[model samples]
Every structure is written in structure tokens, then in C-alpha cells.
Target: MNKAVFLDRDGVINEVLTDRVKFVNRSDQMYFFPGVAEAIRLFNQTFDYVFVVTNQGGVGLGFMKEAQLQAIHSDMITSLQKEGALIQEVVYCPHKPKSGCTCRKPNSKLIEDLARKYDVDVKSSYMVGDTDTDIIAGKKAGTKTVFIGKSDPLADAVYPDLLQAAHWIVDDAT
Candidate 1:
């Protein structure tokens, strides 16, 4: 079975707009955090699949159109690719928090679906994120959870950012 690493997009990959605490509405607003590209490159080399699983509720809230979100993601991918990082796939839940969507973070539908589709060993996989919901979903999906930034009791480990988390994952895997 293949091993995968699931990542949250907002704070994990790009800097979150502090004022809104939401998605980057414009491509120009997209700024990758320090060392994110290098970290993703490491993940690409270490895991069979490096997937981005994020909750993009800005689409549901009408804060940004889906096309705008796509543009931001496109730019982010382009930047990472230039740095030699290849993300296997990106799965996002574009539902409002109260939409009762099973695909949202804190719900395992997205991760579970991807695991089955990719033939992933969920128990051996890792989920890295910067939110409580992210950790909850990873735990529910049966993957080892790593929380970036804030502390979380549910996380298997916590790191300041993705680079540190990547280092831990790589070292632990061996």
C-alpha cells in the first residue's frame, strides 16, 4: 500500500489573510510561507503521494468565486513546481461550515475517499495542517496527525511550520 501526506492549503502552504482569516481571493494575494516549497519538495520525495486536502469555504460564502480560488491554487502549484515539488492531487471542500457537508474538515469523507482511490495505507499516512479541524479529520481518517503552528491536543505532534513537520516525518519514516 502506498503512503501519502495530506496537507492543508491556507496556513500550511500560503499565508492566510490575517484580516479575513479566509482564502486568498486573488492570485496576487497568494504568498507562500517561508520554506513551504522546499518542504513540499521533501514530501514529494518521501511519500508516494503528496495530496492537499483543504476546506475552501470562501467559495460557499461567496467571498470568492471558484474560478478565483482556482487561479490562486494554480499560481501556488506553479510556484511549487518551479521549486521541484509535485503535488499528486488537491481535494477541497467548497462548502459552508454549516452546509452539513461531509467533505469538510473534522469529517473524514475526503481523506477516506482519497485513500481508497489511491490505495493508500491510511494508518501509515500522515496529515499535516494548522487547524483543529484538520487534526480532527486526520485522526478520524486514521492517519498520523501533525499540527503546524498552534497547539492541539489531538495532534500526534506539533511543529512551527511545514518544514519542521516534513523533517520529522522523513526522519520518523526511516
Candidate 2:
């Protein structure tokens, strides 16, 4: 079985644009957070697989089409590849929070699906993200959780950003 590093997309990978107030429907809006690619590269060196499990409620809100989301993801992948990191897979829930979908964060359906499709060892995997939902999903998936923010108290471990979290992961592995 493979150990994975699950990541969140919006706030964790790209800058969380609360003020942008607009849904990220275009590739231009998909900007990488500082050191995010570096963090992924570090994980790629250590983990057997790296996956992205994100909650994209904008699609459910009719703010963007699925194709637009794919375009943005493609651009993100291209950028990450340029940085020498490869995101093994990207999974997102398009349902609104009110939709009660099983795939949404705080739920483990996405991880479960990935485990079924890929040889993921839930017990040995890790989840890194910037939100409570991300930690909760990791917990539900039976993986250790690392929070990528100084403010979130729900995380098992907290760091200022993804790069710091990556450093922690590297330290822990040694």
C-alpha cells in the first residue's frame, strides 16, 4: 500500500482570496500560494503518492462550469510540474455545503474512493491543509493531520504555511 499526502487546493495551495469575492472560474484566478510548489516538491520526495482533495463550492453555486475548473487545475498542474513536483491526482467536491454530499471535506468519501482506486494506506498517510474541514477529513480517512496555519486550533500540528509544514514533515521523517 502507498502512503499519500493529501492537500487542499484553495487556501492551502493558492492564496486564499477572500477579498477577490469572485469565484475562481478563470485560470488567471488560480494563483499559487507562496512556497506551495516547494512544499509539494518536498512531499513528493518523501511520500509514495501526493493527492489533492479540495472543496470547490463555487461550482455548486453556479459560479463556474466543470470545464473551467478543469482548465484551472490543468494550469495548476503545469505550474507544479515546472517546479519539479507532480500532483498524483486531484479530487474536488462540486456540491454546496448544504447539499450533504459524502465527498465534501469533514467526510471521507473522496479519500475512500481514492483508497479503493489506488493502493493508499490510510494509516500511514498524512493530510496537510489550512482549514478545520481538511483536518477533519484527514481524521475520518484515518490519516495523521497537519494544519498549515497559525490560527487553526483543531490541527494536530500547526505551521505558519505549507513550506513550514513541509519542513516539519522532513524533520519527522528523519
Candidate 3:
């Protein structure tokens, strides 16, 4: 079985932006956080597979189309590839919170499905993200989870950003 790195997209790879009028729904508006690519590269060296697990409810709400989300992801992938980082795959739940979807974070369906499909050993994998939901999903999947923003009492570890989180993992390897 292969070890994996399950990452959250927004606030992990890119900085999260909030606006009162609308959610972030455009590729043109997406901005990657600093050092994210290098950190991914480092994680890649230590993990058998690097996957992205994200919850994108905008699609369910009709705020953004799947094509638009793909475009945004494509742009992000292009940027990461330019920096010599290769992500294995990206899995996302496009259902709204009210949908009560099993794939949403804090639920194990997405990660569990990926594990079954890819022969993943969740016990040895790591989940990195910036939200409580991400951490919760990671825990449910039986992987070690790292929280990246706002201190949480239940978090295994906390970091200011993804880059620092990567540094912590790298330091642990040494």
C-alpha cells in the first residue's frame, strides 16, 4: 500500500480570499500562497502519492460551474508544474452543505474511496489543510492530520501556513 499526502486546496495551496458579495469562483482571481510549490515538492519526496482533497460547494449552489473550477485547478497545476511539483490527483466534493453529502470533509467517503481505489495505506498517510473539517476528515480516514490555520484544540499540530507545515514534516524526517 502507498502512503499519501492529502491536501486541501484553498488556504493550503492558495490564500483564501473572502468578499461579502461573492465567493471565490474565478480562475483569474486565484492566487497561490508563497512557498507552496516548494513545500509540495518536499512532501512529494517523502510521500508515495500527493493528492488534493477539497470541498467546493459553489458548484452545487450554481455560483460556479465545474468547468470554471477545472480551469482554476488547471492554472494552479500549471504553476506548480512550473516550479517542479507534480500532484498525483485532485478529489473534490462539489455538494453544498445542505446537501448532506457523504463526500464532504468531516465525512470519510472521499478519502475512503481514494484509498480503496489506489491501494492507499491511510495509517501511514498524512493530511494537511487549513480548516477543522479537513482535519476531521483526516482523522476519520485514519491518517495523521495537520492543521494550518487558527489554533484548534483537537488538532495534532498547527502551523501558520502550508509552507511552515511542510517544514515541520521535513524536520520530522530528519
Candidate 4:
């Protein structure tokens, strides 16, 4: 039984461009939040698997190409790896919100898929995200939910940011 952490990309790992009104369409727009590298480095030491679950609807809506998204992820991963943090895998839903995608946030399909593929113990895992949809997805996947940013009534725990959430997870595991 392996413990894993499922993290949301935008707003969790990277800064979200609220003014853009769409997904991060350019690699130049991808910037990691403060302490995100340190948090992920801690997660690398704490969890058996660290997975990123994101919804890149921009690709489906023609806001950006899939290749551009890949480039952004590549840059992010490379930057994190340079800081000694490794992300095991990144799972994304490349569908528009109206596409009825089963793998998007608020749906456990992607989480379930990762659990099966990685032999994860869902019960002991954690899902950390900035939105209620992330909390719902974690709940549906049978993992503890940690909400970043504003508090959510449905979340198992709330933190001001991903770094705080990481600290809590590490401390709780011990």
C-alpha cells in the first residue's frame, strides 16, 4: 500500500492568471508559487507518489495547443527537478467543461486511474487543491482532502497555501 498526494496544478503549484480568463496558454505564463518547490521537495520525501491532476481545457477550447501545454509542463517539471523535487506523473483532462469529461476535477476518474496504475492506497492518500472541485474529487476518490487558499466546508483540512498543506501532511504522517 503506497501513499500518494494528488495536487492541482494551477493555483496550487503555479500561480493562476485570473486576468487571462483561461488556462495558461503560454509557457512564459507558467510561474510557480512561492515555496512550491520546497513543498514538492518535502512531498517527494514523504509520499510514495506525487501526482499532478489538472484540467487543461484551454487545449480543447483552442485557446492553446496540446504541444504548448506539454511545453509548459515540461518547463515546470524541469524546474522542479532542478530543485530536487520530482513529480511521478501528471494526469490531465484535455476536454472543455461542457464536454462532460469524466476525468476532470470533481470527477474521480483520473484519481482512480492513477490509484490503480500506481497501486496507491486511496484511503491514506491526500488530495490538495485550491478549489472545491478538487476537494470533491478527493472525497469521491476516498482520500483525505486538503483545500488551499479559502476554507471549504467540505474539505477535511484547510491551509493558506500548498506549503502549509505540505507541512501538515508531513507532520501528520509522523
Measured by TM-score, the strongest candidate is: 4
Lowest summed lDDT window (length 10), candidate 4? 15-24
Residue 1 lDDT in model 1?
97
Residues 2-120 of candidate 4 have per-residue lDDT tens digits of 99999999989987866643457887887777899899989889899999999889889888888888888888888899999899888899899878878888999999999999999
**Who is ahead in TM-score, 1 or 3?**
1
TM-score of every prediction relative to native: 0.94, 0.93, 0.92, 0.95
The collision pairs in model 2 are: none
Q: Write the per-residue lDDT of candidate 1 for residues 1-174, one digit (tens) a residue.
A: 999999999888888867644458888777788898888888888789999998989899999898888777777787789889988788889998889989999999999999999999999999999999999999999999999986888899999999999999888766
Q: Is candidate 2 or 4 superior in TM-score?
A: 4
**Where does candidate 3 stray beyond 4 Å?**
18-22
Model 2: per-residue Cα lDDT over 1-174, one tens digit each: 887888888778887666652446788877677898888899888888888899998889898888889888888898899989899889999988879888899898888788778988888788888889899998888888888877666676888788888888767754
Flag regions of model 2 displaced more than 4 Å: 18-22
Question: Candidates' lDDT values, in order?
Answer: 0.89, 0.84, 0.84, 0.89
Task: Quote model 3's TM-score.
Answer: 0.92
Candidate scoring better on TM-score of 1 and 2: 1
lDDT of candidate 2?
0.84
Worst 10 residues of 2 by lDDT: 15-24
